[model samples]
Every structure is written in C-alpha cells, then in structure tokens.
Target: MATSTPEELPSSAMTDEDYGAYRASAALWAGTSVLITDQQGKVLVQSVDYRDTRLLPGGAIDKGESPAHGAARELLEELGVHTVVDRGLAVDWVSADSSGAPAAMRFPGELIHVFDGGTWNDEQIAAIRLPESEITAVDFVAPARLPDLLSPADARRALAALRARINAAGTVLLENGHPIAPTSLDRAGILRTPRARHHFTFHTAPVPDTLALRQSWGWVFAPDGRILLLLEPDTGAPCLPGGTPEPHDHGDATTTLHREAIEEAAARIARTTYIGYLSDPAASCARARYAAVLTAVGAAPVDAATGRTYIRVLATPEQALQQFDWGPAAADQLAAVHQARHRLGIPRAAQQPVTELASPITW
Candidate 1:
C-alpha cells in the first residue's frame, strides 16, 4: 500500500466549501411554518385533507429555496396570502429516532423553522382564499384551543412560536417544541413598572444594567369583581404581589406569579392572562404584569410565618383605585390590566376566566 505524501495530496479538492456540501447532504429534512394572528390574537390554521389535524400555513422547503422563501411560497400557495417573511420566531429540531418513537415510522428527522406572519386586519383575514385541492377550510384558532385543534407536535410548536412573537426578544431554539435552555429574560414579559413622577424628576446616577433585575407584578382578582392587593407588613402601603424572578422559577413569568401569589398572600391563582411588560426607565428594570383570577383554594392565614404580617384584601376595582396610593406608574399599570381584561373578556366571577387556568395554580 502506498500512502500519499502531504505535498502530493490534492488539498485544493477538500476545501471548506466541499466539506459544507458534504454536511448539507446529511439525512435531515427541513420545513417552515408561519405564525399569523388575527386582531384578537387567534392563530390562522387550515384543515388539510392530507392529514387528520390542522396545519399552519407552511410546508417543506424546496431543494434550493431558503426557509423564509419557502415559507413565503407556501403562504401564497396554501392561502393565497402575499407577504414577505422578514423575521423568524423559533427553530425546532424533530428527531424520528428519539423519545421512543416507533421504528415503523418511516419519515426522516426534520429541522423546523417558524416565522412571524404579522397580525392581520379583519378585511385581510376575510380576503384569504385557500386552495381547494389541498386546504379544506381555513379558520382562526385561539391559543387555548390549539391543543385540540392541531396535532400535539404542531400545538407545541405553535404555542412556542406564539410566545416568541409576544416577547419579540429574539429567535428561540427548541427540541420537540420545548425550549433548548432556560430563559434568561422574557422579552414579552419585560415592562416598565409604573412609578411616581417624582422618581423621574431628577435623573439619578445611571444604574448599571448588571444591577438591574427582572421582576413580576401580578394583578390577582377574586370572585365577585374584586382585585387582590397586599398591605405591606411594615408600611401598610398597598402593592401588587410579586418579586424578583428566581432561578427556581425557570425564567417563567407565570411560574414566578404562581409562587409569589401563594407566598405573599396565600392566594391561589386559578387563571392568569399576560397583560404585557412595563419598562421602568428610572430603575432600568422590567416588570412582567399578569391579571390572574383567584379560586376558592387559597386562604390568607391571620398569622402566616413570613416573618412579617401580610394582609390580603379583596377590593373592587374602584376601591383599589381609591385605596392604593400606587404612584402614577403603578396606577397606570393597574389601569392597563383592567383594560386588557376587558378586551380579553375575562369576567371577574369566581369561576375560571375565559382563558384556561394555569396548571397547578398553587406553587
């Protein structure tokens, strides 16, 4: 056997481009999906004859087309919607061999890309025309109904994509529709906390971004149209129940709300609606606010062991506005929560809100 010397070997043929071509030929399929929402935040979906479950307006990428371009092509073909794909929401990897998948499953693994389809107006939604050959019917599905409307895999991907759209922080990486890593900051949840104007009257020395912390403020409501407020054990001032996002919360705003609701007020949140984030330019911090409805499950112990006294009071919206001296900023946040609740059509009854209750309402 004769071994070729380094000088004699044809190094030019084994260039980086050649290696890239080889890697690209690996046994993997790529597909793209879009996340289009109506004015009400419902997702756009179509009933397909090829599969039992509904699908988002997308399909597998062509041999030489980019993912975004493929998504755009699919949108035009599937729903006759003409639009450009400019932003991506999430990237998910699906493995055919993992998770006890049956060997009989013949499909190869896939790399999935999800893009933002931008919210549409009623006129645009009504103008959509689906291809009769592929799509049977097109309709908008609410987030709560996705699990039942779409296949399990699709539901997970759609939910993650929807969340990413809300956050608008950046693209999310996922495996089997789940996040690849713990979230560091939730773009959707970060918001400025309402503060008194006096705090902003004089510019305090800039606080290093490193010193800034992520926090969650919850607007918990009880049955009979009343909001839950906490009386500060020391100052007797009224405030929302919340605190810093702990590592244990897994960077999830809902998890933080669940834990804080119970710890601070012994209150159980039956359901929570993310009202969006409020930014505090003064503090250089973000506050994720949620409007949650309490169930009959929680109780405020007269003397809980929090090393301080916490009084949980349920008050009507008007009462909350009158009683709490929540400076202008906080007051604005509270008002916004109410407005969001109204728009979401969440009633203040003791029953579950329009949205499904967050699981395990307790910590």
Candidate 2:
C-alpha cells in the first residue's frame, strides 16, 4: 500500500511573522552629539540642568544631518564655538531612552561619532546663541579633574578620548614656551601627583587576602578642626566612625559611604572629597579593592543617645594616627585617609596618644 506524504503549510497561514513585522515598525530612532576640545591639554565642558554635573556640549542630530555636520552645528548653536574637523575620534554605540523617563530612558542604541577639532582660545570662541530653555552654562575644565567633575562613567569615557588626543599630539606647549611631553604626565593622566598607589600596595598592605573587600570609612570634622573618632567597644583603638557596606546599600560609593557613616556612628555626613584607592602589595584572594575620603559637612553629635553635647576639638594628623589603632588594615587605611586629607588641604590636628591605654571596638 502507498502512504500519502504530509501536506506542507502555505506561507499565507503564518500569523507570527506578521506580528513580528508590526513590532519592528513600532521601534523609534534617537541620537545625541558630544563636542570635545582641549585647552592647554585639558578638556572643556559645559553644565546642563538635566544632569547633576557638567558635560560636553552636543545635541540631537536633526533629520538629514550627518553626525560630523551635526557636531559642528550643535557646538556653534550651544556654545557659539566653531572649528575645523581634524578627523574622526571615535564611534560608540550607546543605548539611550526617548521617553524622557523620570530616570534616564534607554535608547535601543546610539551611534556616537566623535571627531577631532583643534583647540580654540576664549577670544577665538564664537558667540554662543542657545535658547535659554536648552542650555545654562559653559566653561573650560581640566582633563585630570574630569573624573571628579563629571559622573564616573562619563568621566572614564571622556578621559579615554582626551588621552587619545594627547597621545596624538605627542607633546603639549605650555603658555611659557615650554614643550612638555606625555612622559611628563603619568600614564594615568596626572601631573605633580604623589606616589599614591605605591604608598598603599608597597608600603601599607590594606588587604590581607585578595577577596575584593570595599569598606566605608568617614572622618567627621568640626569647625574647630577636631575629627570625630570612634573607640571600638572591643578594640579601644581610636578610628573613624564608619563601617563595612551592607548588602542592601543602595547608590554609588559616596552614597554607600554616607549611609554607612549614619548607621555606624549615628552621624550624618554633609560633604565629601574623593581620595583614591589602596591595595595589597601582593595579589590577594579578594576581588575588589578601592578607597575614598570624605570631610564632615556639618556638626556631628557627641552622643547619639542624648543628642545634646557637641564639642569642637582639633587633632593633628600625627595625633589622630597615634590615638587610633585601625585593626588589621589600620596602617594602609589610615595612610590613604591622610593622603586624601592632605590633598584636600585639611590641616592635621595636634594630639598625643597614650600608648599605655588599650581598648578595642568590636566589628
């Protein structure tokens, strides 16, 4: 007996394909422009109310506009600046949002085309003519300080671009007729910088094992210059009133540090200054290694329970170091803290530690 073969489905019977086509038609397109310039080898930035910090000036590329043409037009409109495009700097695919979500909305992907524009002085800058509704302020900013002035991620990307330009130039001419080469600046893009990283890993080993440990520590300062030190209930060693970040800690490193300070010391920190990182000399089993610094913005309570006493006393750096025993990582941690403080121009207080007195705080 001959068996009949199964009949094939007709293309007209496919309903799923039609639905997929409909979804593709509903997708939207969006784009943004980022303008960069180097002044004396520093990056120039502008401020926008939409973001908490400053950013490069650029906006959406209108229909029928190439990214290069859009960048030149946007810069002129936003900052009244004009320049000759040197070359394409970079092209990045970024995701952004079109909904203007209360938080940043994500776009499916953005084609960011970066171009090189030779430096322009203030006199050479064209007249800026942006609508007040779109722009607020414009200014020049240093490249090394970009990390602090801009959001960390933006800073990192901008730094990469800025460094690329610096490398291409090979040497920067100072106003004093001095030609400074890239070698003058460290590979990390800092000049006249202290031996920060070396002091941590080589001199003071902050981590015992390499398991990526990030702890939050805050130094509370009074107007009189006295820093608040917490005597651990278990160790009696003098140290800053801060603790390890909790699993639920939300927000960035600074936010986590502030939250930790409030929880451990019962004091709220108002202001902060980023110090830098410290690590172990040898590779540790830990995965994370970073450090930061913060100066107290306002007065902290002497006793969280009573909420009554507030005293302002200053401690010298030496005194503060001597009085506090930082536990296992004390030496490395304190060194990082002091280094940050000095960089920020905070004067160390003068106080003597009585080595005979012993006490420790329990974690």
Q: Give the TM-score of candidate 2.
A: 0.38
Error of 2 at 346 (Å): 48
Candidate 1 per-residue C-alpha lDDT over 1-363 given as tens digits, one digit per residue, 9 for 90 to 100: 211443443356666565555555556889999988775456799899887889888999999999999999999999888899989999999877643545686657889999999889888888788886989998886565677878778887887777566434478898988777523122111111111222221111332345344777777775555566665544444467777778899877789888877777667776677775655677766567777777643545433335654655555554444333333454555566677567545664342111212223343
lDDT of each: 0.66, 0.47
* lDDT by residue (tens digit), candidate 2, 240-280: 54555556765255566676555545455555755434453
- Looking at model 1, the pairs that clash are 167-188, 191-277, 191-278, 191-279, 192-278, 192-279, 192-280, 194-329, 194-330, 195-329
10 residues in a row with least lDDT, candidate 1: 186-195
Best by TM-score: 1
